[model samples]
Target: MSEFQTKVSPDSETFARNRKDMLALVERMRALEARAAAKSEERRPVFDKRGQLSPRERVSALLDPGLPFLELYNMASYLVDDPDPDTSIPGASIILGIGYVEGVRAMVFADDAGINAGAMTQKSVDKALGAIAIAERQKLPFIHLVESAGADLMRYTVELWAHGGGMFAGLARLSAAGIPVITVLHGASTAGGAYQPGLSDYVIGVRGNGMAMLAGAALVQAATGEAAQDADLGGAEMHAATTGLVEYLAANDAHGIEIAREVVSGLGWKACGPALPVCAEPLLPPDQIAGVVPVDYRTPCDMREVAARIADGSDLREFKPDFGPATLCLQARIMGQPVGLIGNNGPLDPDGAAKATHFLQAMDQAGTPVVFLNNTTGYMVGTASERAGMIKHGAKMIQAVTNLRVPKITLYTGASFGAGNYGMCGYAFGADFLFTWPNAMTGVMGGAQAALTMEQVARRTAERKGVEADEARLAAQRAKITAHFDRQSDAFYTSGRVLDMGMIDPRDTRAVLGFCLHTCQEARARQLNPNSFGVARI
Candidate 1:
């Protein structure tokens, strides 16, 4: 009886427009992901000559067949790598995501070695480190397909070199924490990259192709005048036989992948909890999500309409629905996971913030995970709102979100501007996982509002000086401010900067939520085997 009544109107022109814009954005997101794959594919010939499989092919081979591979940060370093829309190859020269490996879900990080020799950039390094953090926190095994040319010296910054050390540190930490860290060296992993396989619990190196050593023959000859072939110095066979570095040495790339899968399979890892309730798909079709949200978030639509398609059986039990009507707190089961979802039908007033604060604590106490659907234009501003203890109650909601021990997952379905972003568990608050729809935008405020505020300040300055505001100059300035905000607030651009995990297609929201929710809960239930140190070379 408490289930939300769907009020979606698919037949309306607004729905048609929303559907069209949303689909275009989703297509754009996919096209960019394809671009990264294409860039890697172009290097197939080079990899073929070396008798090595491409980065993505290695991932495909490593993961179990036909299961979901939830790719993370596909648009990573998108425009940041190369600003041009035609040429920016994102994903930091890596194909990284979470997928099932030999029936065990693991975090897979593969150097898209075909691109820039799978060179590590600032973004790429950060991405890998982020995945490792997830693995250690979520209890997922970490698998790395190593074949990196190391850091790009041409673009080197001291900060990047220093930050890149975290990748090796993360692997070491994973091993020490008893979360398996597996490295399959498909090709060269020299210099700083050598430690990647070295720190892992299990290292599988390919006999002819794989190489892992602190120094290569060129570097060794340059420093110490010791000239030797690559294999004799640091080849997989050498490491396996002489140094005790590699646990398994395979004949080639495919064989190396097989070894990695077998290593995971041998872990005998399983989910520690009882089976979840059966998931009956929502009554409202998922594709309808495209039509539910207007791309220009200023256009208002019921958040419940979107919720209907995401919650199972299209049921969302509204909590305190009468008070703080603009803020929605709903109890729902997403793929059998009990969740408290908070969404904004409008800006958060004092009442709304207070209500959300109470709801967050309830969910926390109940041990239920929370999902923040970011869409507010921040807490309400102006004289009336200020008098209502806006800041006090807003801070309480944020505190509750920050202190929550239960898993926090955030999704930016539309506009999330100002303090609303923070109050609703934005990135800085450390939501366990954060994702966005292609249409989502978040910032201090919307472009129009920002530009208008500046214009008002300019006009006020002129009025005080007893001079008329220059209409043309004022108009030009407003346009400039709006354009700057619009460009930076774009989902693709933000996702490129690693602002969110990735830009997801709106239709896949439900499935992605289920997977993430399950992952978080499983991690909480599973026990870890702690040790004194990471697997050492000695």
Candidate 2:
């Protein structure tokens, strides 16, 4: 065939028809090209400032270098203002994808802050749901780097009724699956949107950036007659120290992402069990020594510091630290075995109790063994606790412990008084082992206070004798138990009863924990059927 064909001129009518078709095709091509250009330009805005990295950049930093990120629903975009505005961003408000972190696959959703203040659109919700569905099917753990203005308002007005407002249902379903969902709160995550991270298993937050709560100060003031700043409303400190919502607090973005990656690396691919350690430390530190148990029980020690000293270095992950100031709960590895560390701080407020209950339930479900470091004054007292219903919520902790199938060990460090003693797995609380330090005091109430109970008899005797009450007798009575507890022999003998009753080993203070943790790790490994190099026994 010739390079150029011989032209056969068409009839006038036919030429006109052919021209019209060509023009229509050209117009459609131009429209398609315009759409393509717009889609190409719809990527995240340029990164500015040392503090702020784009959502994709943050996600990329978390995952392994150059890992394939297969984005879900990349073409999704919202219809703002007009029925279908010509200029609309693509990839939805959040970018959902499957990527690898440390060579292990993970389902990820990074909120695009550059897109409409990072507000979640109906399309974004669908994308998130779709990504979660993929994770569920593949059993991949989900990680969300959330930083958004919550539900997109412009697209959610009455005229745009088709645009769904919230993402509660989809996120709830993802959480219900019980797979490890790690949320890294990069920036402003407020209102209903923040709950997604709040409900997650592990929420890693930047010190000044990560915030998860019901409403911001502006909304609160608008709705109620209250004035509060963003920080006062739901800042990192509030969630960490007050609400106990944040699981891990990071120093900065780098630190936050590093911690998040560590969390994921720890989980591996398994959702049902914990990973074993490579090497076991013989004895952790001062926290487990039992020597310091009697040292000023009233002193407020950072439970995080205590847990760190006991567990393997950098292996302690505390949960709900803010909520339950009176009690401490941590998930950590001791000598390579996963164990839940529960302790008492003095007394936590009502909010603290609720947070503790939630942690207890989670720890139980994870099938991890628990170690209780008991040192509590009592349950919180006051109208706040009563109104919050500490009694009802605190019951969940007891119920969870009673129903727990895993091994539990309790060590009374100091004054395990009143309900606090019972809260931390008392003698009858079904703990596999219970131990008390030499100088520890576990009773219904403090010694000096209990001695004053016989006031009527003292008053009558004093009245008859026409003299002041005998304060010396009260001191003597209080000293009686103190003398008994002070005897090293008596302390060991009493501990022996605990040992005899299968509560704990009477000796080997710090070493016992290491041994117990090692045993637990071995047991879990066997249960999980880890890869073995040996033959079966006869």
Candidate 3:
């Protein structure tokens, strides 16, 4: 302790001065970065769309407060002859980084349409690939805002294998990693850009700004002589209504960003539980939820209100509110348990199979218990339906539900007919339990439709047998067929192969649901942690 004790501590003034100097150095570096940013801005082209927010700006609005964006490939770009000297603007067309959305860590990448029409350069591809690799390695959600003019033809001329793009390879690798990938289309997303989002788990589009496909109008016209407008070529309506490429159709850019936030929050993040409350509310008045009787099968009812009532506290975060309007899927808490609810839109247009498949797949991965609220007249029909590839699209839902491992509870709020029953997670469709309220008039088809069919059958039989078919008897037969699987009996759990091995106790809906949630919670052992990380996107 001789020499050490002899050494005196530095004076407070000297220490303070050194600390100030270090801070000053940091400020100086920040000023230099700002100056570089300003110089880059000076070189940006004054294009037709100046008011539109940049990708970085959009990301700023979308992410959580106080979180920093670790920009990937910040200095990677064209070496020379680039008209736009704003290096920060394009960042090689793809901006990949890790950031926090709502305090949840996630990987975010965006195709900057403002730069080279968001073309995919080799540098950009590498940046994207690297970002996704990081995301997968870290088990973070990957968000992509794609809006590109496809790959840079300039980068491809030298190599014939350029056609065998490495971009697809990167996407395949990212998909195989099983990281929840979410995409938002804010502008034209065609060819390679379109393919990037195509492989993601969740894809959303803005009504006017979003688009996706192998070819746009100009290319289609050049190749097939098909002149088309933007909407006809690749718009939100085109994808949502026909191709089913977009899972959600946003009302506008703001709507799109909000939807993106929701999607990110709902991603399969095991670090934090859902924010929705699970306490079940008191049963709604009988008048509010009209009983699902035989007559109710043909009648269209607003399933949304029904969903709100069923979800505890009536707070449900409905996904894809606009697109795939026919099928209503929501994330909510029932009796304090995370529940994924899928319902049938009584009158809204079925957005087609692509959306159905997407919804089912998303729900399956969410790892939340599922609730099916059936109310549909089966799949859409006619040329419009065929054009949207309904058969192929809807089949995706069937396959997903079959493959899903979560406990599914079906509540026949109204009609459950034909494929609609299956789509709504019918008893045979792997639902753990199917329950109907006292008003439920369960059947293979609507009694009215059955009545009409019986009328036709009666006429056919009368003509052949030369005898008057008993209309009353025929009516009874129609009722029997309507209630074939589930007779219009009370809500008792029956046995011996009738309607879901017999219906669960109807009056016990509240109790049954609460018990099921408790059982599920116990099975999982997910206790509330005071040190909960809360909802995070990454």
Return the candidate ranking by lDDT, descending.
1, 2, 3
User: Residue-wise lDDT of candidate 3 within 1-538, one digit each (tens)?
Assistant: 0010111122445334433543343343345335434543442453225334566566776788774554444433433214343433325665566677766567788776656677766555555655654554445677888777777887654332363365556555555555567888888877756766677667788777788877878888999998888777778778888877788998866677789998877753543434435365734421223232222345454565555545566666767778877788777766777788787766223473456567667766877778877777677767887677677766767777777777677786556676766777775775555555434444455555666776798889898999988878887887776564444321221111124322232334545565445434433443222212222222
Cα lDDT listed for each candidate = 0.88, 0.60, 0.59
- TM-score for all predictions? 0.98, 0.42, 0.43
Ten contiguous residues with the weakest lDDT in model 1: 1-10
In candidate 1, what are the lDDT values of residues 1-538, reduced to their tens digit? 2566677778999889999999999998888888888878998888899888888888889988998899898889988858998888889988888999887878999988888988888888878878988898899999889999998877788978998989878888898998998889899998898878878889998988999888888889999999889999889999899999898989999999988888887998866655777887888988899999999888997888888788998888899999999999999889988899999999999999999999999999999999999888899999999999999999999899889999999999998888899999987888889999999988888888899999999999999999999999999999999999988888888888888888889899999999999889888888888889966777
User: What TM-score does structure 1 among the candidates reach?
Assistant: 0.98
**Tens-digit per-residue lDDT, 191-284, candidate 2:** 7677777657788877777777688887888999798888777777678777777778888777888898899888745323355347534333
RMSD in angstroms, all models? 1.2, 30.4, 27.6
Q: Using lDDT as the measure, which candidate wins?
A: 1
